[model samples]
Target: MRQMHGAWPKDALPHRIWDESYMELQHATRQHEFVTSLYVQAKLNTRALLDQVIPAYEGVFSDLYSATSLQVLRAVCKDKWMRRRL
Candidate 1:
């Protein structure tokens, strides 16, 4: 981004890092939900809250998931979501 925007400053580094993490976590959570939602379309009557992973999923951060992504969303519904596990 800096190449065209002229150079990212040192002071913006921390914010940039935080922003990256926030988006990553959000996406993982979303992916988990997406799968379950699709499963719901199949009418399995399952229950799982894999969307709320406490420890958070860990994997490669990349602009292209197919290229460098090593992460996999593990659907595990605990608490209220446990009742719907299929």
Candidate 2:
């Protein structure tokens, strides 16, 4: 034990290094959770806008819009198959 202690510098305790790493991991986890929450909120808002608001203009601009684009958006947003592709 004395030899081991002598091998490392005074400021370089293994326990202290482990504690600092643990603290850094905890901080990273909190940051990941915060970013994930923001992503969920943005996804929910986009879903709401796509599902509820865009349909209101469907009839008015039915002839002006491309059928293929509308179909692809509906598939990716509302259908399960395209969502799996995402």
Candidate 3:
């Protein structure tokens, strides 16, 4: 036991390094998953809010969250704001 304990310092370094690296990779993977989930949840919440606010938009745009849809929405909102100001 004493001999093994004495050799532990020499043996532990290389052996333990990989375990730390693997743990760090796992932590990074978990963080990425958490961030992706939050993004998906935000998209779902946005869709739900849009359903209540502009349910007709879904019928008009095949994908309500597409680039073209967003651009059209921006243009419409700008037009509305301009009209309101006038």
Please name the candidate that would achieve the greatest TM-score relative to the true structure: 3
TM-score of each: 0.29, 0.43, 0.65
- For model 2, the stretches where C-alpha displacement exceeds 4 angstroms are 1-18, 56-86
Query: Which of 1 and 3 is the better model by TM-score?
Result: 3
Judged by lDDT relative to the true structure, which candidate is superior, 2 or 3? 3
For residues 3-57, write the lDDT of model 3, one tens digit per residue. Answer: 3554465445545345778999999999999999999999899788878878887
Best-first order by lDDT: 3, 2, 1
Best by lDDT: 3
In angstroms, the error of model 3 at 83 is 4.9
Candidate 1, residue 63: Cα displacement in angstroms equals 42
Candidate 2 lDDT over 1-86, as tens digits, reads 34445568665765544577899999999999999999989867755676585665445445323797567667656777666878
Better of 1 and 2 by lDDT: 2
Alpha-carbon lDDT of model 3: 0.83
Model 1: number of backbone collisions: 4
What would the C-alpha RMSD of candidate 2 be, to one decimal place? Answer: 11.5
Between candidates 1 and 3, which one is better according to lDDT? 3
In order, the Cα lDDT scores of the candidates are 0.47, 0.68, 0.83
Q: How far out, in Å, is residue 64 in model 1? A: 39
- Which scores better on TM-score, 2 or 3? 3
Flag clash pairs in model 2.
none
